[model samples]
Target chain A: MGNFLLVTIQVDLYDRLALNLEADLVQMVNKTGAKGVLIDISAVSIVDSFMGRIIGNIASMSKILDAETVVVGMQPAVAITLIELGLPLKGVQTALNVERGMDLLKTMIDESPIEDEQEYPEDDPFAQ
Target chain B: MILSLSKDNIEVVREQDVVLLRNRVKEVAVKIKMGLLNQTKLITAASELVRNMLRYGNGGTCLIEVVSRGRDNGVRLTFSDQGPGIADIGQAMRDGFSTGKSLGLGLPGSKRLVNEFDIKSKVGEGTTVMILKWANG
Candidate 1:
């Protein structure tokens, strides 16, 4: 939690950039040995399926490396777009903003073995 | 309508073209004062469809315009490609369906993002997808 990484994406990312980000993020997770990764995407308004999958992959990769990932500051539109894209963003934890994400990360780190997965209804958009 | 704008067209052949197309959609959405959520959804849908045009089809043309009917105003985007075309449109629209080994969320997922979606294709001719997002939705 104290060593979490904060990444902000400010531009519209093409496919290649998205792939590069995925690779770089995983590497950073391993190198820093951070307990959590917080990505601030408040500036990004649009999200395609490709971007959605890349985010999901990044979370999975980080989790395997013994790190928690909290994506913060997601615009309502982007979340809504991803939901409609049929990507549940599984295994990814989200927070309203950077502060809340940091708090969640700290709590997870303090609690150890963050195992609870808040379930959603069958029709819920974020349900995975 | 104060949002009347001329037709804007772009050619989608390479990966860069996809980004450009999405930007154009965003511009039109902004002109119509479409909400941030609507703009995001429209741009995302445009990105997916443009990539589909480049991936499955032999590159295509995207037409962007601000459309108004009576009192309703919205942004409309139509993508047309003269690629090999889809032999089975129904099968292609199913979720998690892909022939190129991708995630297969291009078509059906994009359709769900916009307010209006229409697709037409011929086996050997081409395919065209049209989408619209209303301002007040």
Candidate 2:
């Protein structure tokens, strides 16, 4: 929980709101320096292709900032709609619920191999 | 033998109208005793098309109707817009084809959610999209 950011989408999000959330979530990741992000969408009933793109974008953006994102609690209906919409949510991790999402995120972060000390010499400016 | 039960009209003139349209679609789907998965498909398809109307067509009119063919009942939606019409209907229906900043899934994706999908567009006049989803089918 210390290095994780949690976001729960409780309402059906309009286009503008969904876009804004994508921007804000990425900003939050940068600000908090969180290692992982968990987005709960169990309450959201619809996931159009646009919304699907936003979720995918969030995952890609967070990964760029060295943060892993796990979207959790998707309704079964929503999942079917997304697939029918031709958005399989590739490259994005998903979980059945928040608890599982958190555990998955933790495992992802923990399982990442530590960088070898020799790879980044102390004199390398990028290492800092 | 498709018989129309009842119908309503909604104007898509703004972003909120799309949201309102989604809710209205759900209401109609429920009134027809549509299943949960069918309702979700209806609402989601309505949301995608209505938003397309707002974005490309500068808003339009949507006619929502309940229809029955034999014993099977379904919801039908028709969206009409008098905006800059699509130049190529064939290309437009293809997935991943967009003139806007979107994923280009609205038209094709909406088609997949409904039982029937039809589109008619004239270059200078306008574009119309109609879709139907049966309650049990």
TM-score for all models, in order of appearance: 0.87, 0.93
State the DockQ, from 0 to 1, for candidate 1: 0.66
lDDT of 2 by residue, B63-94 (tens): 99999999999999999999899999889899
Clashing pairs in 2: none
Candidate 2, residue B119: the lDDT equals 95
**Model 1 agreement with the true structure over B1-137: per-residue lDDT tens digits:** 43546698899888888877877777778877898888887888888898889888979899888888778898888899998888888999999889896789999988888888999999789999998888886
lDDT of 1 at A110: 76
Model 1 segments more than 4 A misplaced: A113-128, B1-5
Query: Which ranges in model 2 have alpha carbons more than 4 Å from their true place?
Result: A114-128
DockQ for every model comes to 0.66, 0.69
What lDDT does candidate 2 reach at residue B60?
97
lDDT of each: 0.85, 0.91
